[model samples]
Structure formats: C-alpha cells, structure tokens
Target: MSPALALEDLAVERGGRRLLHGLNLTLMPGQAAVLTGPNGAGKTSLLRTIAGLQRPAAGRVRCQPDAIAYAGHADGVKSALTVSENLRFWAAVFGGDQIAPALAAMDLSALGDRLAGRLSAGQRRRLGLARLAVTGRPVWVLDEPTVSLDSRSADLFRAMLAAHLAGGGAAIIATHLDLGIEALRLELSEFAAPRDAAPLSGFDAAFA
Candidate 1:
C-alpha cells in the first residue's frame, strides 16, 4: 500500500529564519511519528507546512488533497456554539457524517449541549481534538494535542488515536507528554538553524 504521508527534503522557514532543511519522513497507514524538539526548534512550523497553512522555502509535502486533519495549539472552537454544534459545523465543512463518533471518541457526549465557552480548558481541548475525528481524513497532524487535557481526557485521546491507526490512518504528533504508544520518535535538533536575533513579527513580517 502507498504511504499516507511523505516529506521529501522538507525545508521550512518562519519569521525569516530557516527552521528546518533537508528533513525527510514517510508515514504509512497505521503508523505514527512523534516530533520532539525544544521551543524555537520549528516543530509547529513543520506541521503547519504539512497542513498547507505555511509554505516551505523548498522541498515537498506529499499527501492526497484533503487527506490531513490538523489540530494546532489553539483549540479552534466556536465559544458561542454548543459542543455538539461545533462538531457538526466542522463535519459539515469537511463533508463528513460521523459527528457522533467524534463526540464519543473525545468523551464529549455528555457535554454536547453545553456552550463551548462554558467548558473548562481541558474540555475545550477535547472539543478541539474531536474536530479531527469528524474530518474523516486519513492523516492527523497534531501539535500539542494533550496541552490542557487531564488524565482521563488524555487517555481518551490516546484510545481514539489507537483506533484511528488500527483503521489504517496515520498520525504526526508534536507533543511533550508521553502517550504510551509506540511511535517513530523524530527529533528536529539536527535539522535546526540558529538565529542571530529574534525573527520578524506582526505586519512588518507578514507584509515583507
């Protein structure tokens, strides 16, 4: 079978700094890769590149269009909407019909009717992860997925990820917490580039 995702000599730049270069990876169905690096090491930049939210200065990201479901550091939830409605909205956007399973996978069924703004940080994070399940995509690109999750919610995430892999999905996770699952441990230090000063920021950076 073909690989679920591939990075060919992937070079990524952020804030005028070349963060990653000549990085290569291949993730097959049912496999996972954990990105490990300290702050400023470009882990988020790499994942954002894979998610098509950023452009690499060079190299290639190989995956089917719409194959990736990305969950970044931000919860990306609509605070005014109820938990269930948030998932339904994402499902509609992604053309998926499995909102119920997404809710159950995140242990969110009980909180379905509650407004997202009323949820605790952990609950909000779970709601963010649930969005991934509703995408019906084969590849999950997650950055800090367990950020605010408590033990139970974290376990729910782990279980959900296991199920995704068992069903022939792929995952690329950047996390410091131990998920207790066997995954290819990928470190980004070797591919790092040092910066002389803090890189660009705000409109000056964006418009440059």
Candidate 2:
C-alpha cells in the first residue's frame, strides 16, 4: 500500500522569502511525526502546506484527496455552539457520524450541553481536538495541538493519537511540548533557509 502522505523536495516560502526547502518525508499507516523547532522555523508552514491550506514554493506533496484533517493553533470552536453541536456540525461536514465516540474519546461527554464560550481554555481545546476524531480522515495535521491542555488532557490526547495510529491512521504534529507518544522527530531548524535569504516583510511576515 502507498504511504498516507509524502513530501518530495518540497519548499515553502513566506513574505516572498523561503522558509523551508528541499524537504522530503513520508508517513505510512500507523506512523506519526512530530515537528520541533524554534518559532519561525517553518513548522507551521510545513503543516499548512501539507494540509493544502497553503501552496508550496516547489516540489510536491502527495496524499489522497480529503485525507487530511488539520487543527491549527487556534481552536476552531464556535463560541455560541454547545459542545455536542460543534462536534455534530463537523461530523456532517466531514461525512462522519462519530459524535458520541468523539465526545467520549476527548473526555467531553459531561460537557455536551455546555456552550463552547463558557468552557475553560482546556475544555475548549478538547472540543477543538474532538473534531479530529469526527473527521474520519486517515491523515491528521495538527499545530500545537496540546496548547492550553492540562497534564491529564494532554495524556488523553496521547492515548487518542496512539489509538489512531494503531488503527492505521497517521499524524503530523508540530508541538513544542513532549507529546508522550512514540513518534519520529523532525527538527524544522535543519530545513531552514540560509541566513542570506531575504527577510520576510509585511503580510509574508505573518506566516513566519
């Protein structure tokens, strides 16, 4: 079987300046990769490029269509929607029907009826992550997925990721904190552009 995701000599740029170049990696079923680097090292850029949210400057990123479910630094929860409502909406968008399972997996069953805006930061983060379970996609691209999560919630996330991999799913996570899950580490700094590269400015600096 083919790998779930592949990047070949891929290059990403921000502010008309290259941030990452000549990057190559492959993720197979039941595998995960954790991207680590200082801020502006292109970790987010790589994930965004893979998720098809941003175009790469060169080379290729290959994956099955609709295979990626991405969770960015910001929680994608609707403040007005209840926990259950948020999960249900995502399930419908992603062609999944796993709301109950997702809620249970994220340890959010008890908060089902609570409006998202009323939840604490950790709870909101959990709800954001629950969307991944409902996506039913084989490939996950998450940026700082554990941010704002307490130790227990982080542990829960590790367990969820492990289960997903065991079930033949793959994940690419960009996080500064240790995930407590077995995954190959990719240091984004190694792929950084040369010091002589043009400095990012204006709108491009936003991505940096």
User: Highest TM-score among the candidates is held by which one?
Assistant: 2
**How many pairs of residues collide in model 2?**
1
Q: Looking at model 2, report the run of 10 residues with the lowest lDDT sum.
A: 199-208
The lDDT values for all models are 0.89, 0.89
For model 2, which pairs clash? 15-204
What residue runs in model 2 are displaced by over 4 Å at the alpha carbon? 198-208
Q: Which ten residues in a row have the lowest lDDT in candidate 1?
A: 196-205
Q: Which residue ranges in model 1 land beyond 4 Å of their true spot?
A: 194-208
What would the per-residue lDDT of candidate 2 be over residues 1-208, giving only the tens digit for each residue?
8999999998888667788888899999998999988888988878988998877888999999989999998889999999999999999998876699889888999999999999999999999998999999999999999999999999989888888999999999998777777888888888888867765354555765
lDDT of 1: 0.89
Candidate 1 residue pairs that clash: none
In angstroms, the error of model 1 at 88 is 0.8
